[model samples]
Target: MFTRILTSALFAGAAAGLIAALLQLVFVQPVLLHAELYEGGELVHFGGDSTVPAEQDLGGLSPVRDGLSIVFTMMIYSGYALILVPLMALAQERGARIGARTGLIWGLCGFIVVHFAPGFTLAPEVPGVAAADVGLRQVWWFATVLAAAVALWLVAFGRGWAAWGPAVVLLAAPHLVGAPEPEVFTGPVPTEIGALFAARAFGVGMAAWVMLGGFAGHFWARETAGRDAAAQPA
Candidate 1:
């Protein structure tokens, strides 16, 4: 059981993470680097002297930095898969079908739970964006993620209003309490760039999560089947 979970999670997570890292580099990094320029006073929003570079340095193509990024991304997705595969197994035990298609739905739910849910309150930030106290925000973020995770699980597996009623409350409770806010909204990054970064980040997250779920489902099913077959008369 341990081996199955580890292998499935690692394979699925690594594959998904690799792709996600590439996508983030292509679609998200430029916006981030641009935002940093503003944050660092290298670029001014309205100053006549400031001109957008034809191409941003993008960290000078540092292999070490980029390589570490890929590895870190893989680790993160692998961690997510570690959580997801066990859940998949549990779901299967409860008669839930596991497959690539189903996994896509699961992936979407995961995205909603982890990214969209917290983001709905906090939104993604760039380098210069003014925000709440870090410790306070971290507390709120963790609570929100936990609440969202429970709500989703209950909604998925629990039966009738008994399960759903609480799910709704759990889902709404955090938002009602609200996330910590800055004393005042302030930041060096352009609103447009921040907005674009948030949008692209969410988009890339959705894609990565869907792929992760599909790969996880595929591998989990295959591993389980193989184990079962090995146990059968032979």
Candidate 2:
């Protein structure tokens, strides 16, 4: 049973991760490159003498980087699938529906857990943006993800308000506590560019997460169906 689930997770995760990497290159990397211009003093904010070097212009789109992106994405999404698929099975056992629809819902829940929940405080960082220490941000981010995931699970699977009320609190706790802030809000990137980066980053993440859930659900359903068939009387 675990083997089947693991196999489904690996397949679905790889597919979703590959798709995500492609989407990130298309949607997110350009902005990231642009932000680098400001960070590296190659392009000034607002208005200035800007002649972006050819090297800087195309630096963000690298074949090697893209390869790494795909590899990292695959590993990350596969890890997520490994965790999610089992929870999905448990949810099904507990009478929740388990299919694409539920999977999509779960995916959205995942986004809320990792992205939106943390985003409320941290937001996405652009290359030129200056903010909080990396270590502090990571600590907060991990805590937020944990809190949000548990909160979502409780609300989704818990029996009643007794469970749900606390879920809401958990969801709010991290935000209420707030994310780590930099000593000063300073960056070379424009407010508009930074804002756009954050929005696009979230958009890309949402897309990837949705795809992850959809694929995982599809594969999981198929594998479980096969198992059920094998167990049935001939």
Candidate 3:
């Protein structure tokens, strides 16, 4: 079972990560490069003195950087898979169906727990955004993700008000306490560019997660069946 879980997660995570890398390169990278121009004072917004050149191209792709990005994304997604597959097993043990179609829903839930929950209070930031202390933000982000995950599980699988009641509180607790914030919000990145970056980031994330869930489910089913077959009489 342990071997099955590890192998399935690695294979699924690698496939999904590749897809995610392509999507980020195409959709998210250009917006990031554009925002960096503002951060570096090359492009000024709101009528500031600027050193802007006409027909500027936001092309900063490099082989080394992109290669590293691909590798990093794969590792990150694989880590995410390690968390996700065990939960799928638990859900199966509790009599929940697991398959490609259902995995899409699982993937969406994983996205909500890991990404959307934290992002609700702390939206994705550009290079030059004003923000809270890094340590505080990291603490809050992890707490929110943990709270959201437990809350979601209770809502999905828990029985009666005993479970439902705590689930609601868990979901609300993080938001009620609130995320740390800057005293005054200010940044060189324009609102339009920032908004676009956030949107694209969410889009790419959803696409990757959906693929991860499907692949993970498929591999899990395959491995389990293989094991069962091996144990059966000839």
**Candidate lDDT values, in order:** 0.90, 0.85, 0.88
In order of appearance, the predictions have TM-scores of 0.93, 0.92, 0.93
Cα lDDT, model 2, residue 145: 94
Ranking by TM-score: 3, 1, 2
Task: Give the lowest summed-lDDT range of ten residues in model 1.
Answer: 46-55
Error of 2 at 82 (Å): 1.2
After superposition, candidate 3 runs with Cα above 4 Å error = 47-56
> If ranked by lDDT, best first, what sequence of candidates would result?
1, 3, 2
Q: Write the per-residue lDDT of candidate 1 for residues 77-146, one digit (tens) a residue.
A: 9999999999999999999999888999899998988889999989988789999899999999889988
Give the per-residue lDDT of model 3 (tens digit) for 1-234.
798889989998999999999899999888888898888988887645544543459876888988898999999999999999999988988889887888888888888888888988888887888999999999999999999999989988999999999999988889999999999977977787899999998889999999999988888878777877999999
| Candidate 1 Cα lDDT to native | 0.90
Expressed as tens digits, the lDDT of each residue in 9-84 for candidate 2 is: 9987898889888888898888888888788886775535534442444454588878898899889989999988
Q: Which candidate gets the maximum lDDT versus the true structure? A: 1
TM-score of 1: 0.93
**What is the alpha-carbon lDDT for the whole of candidate 2?**
0.85
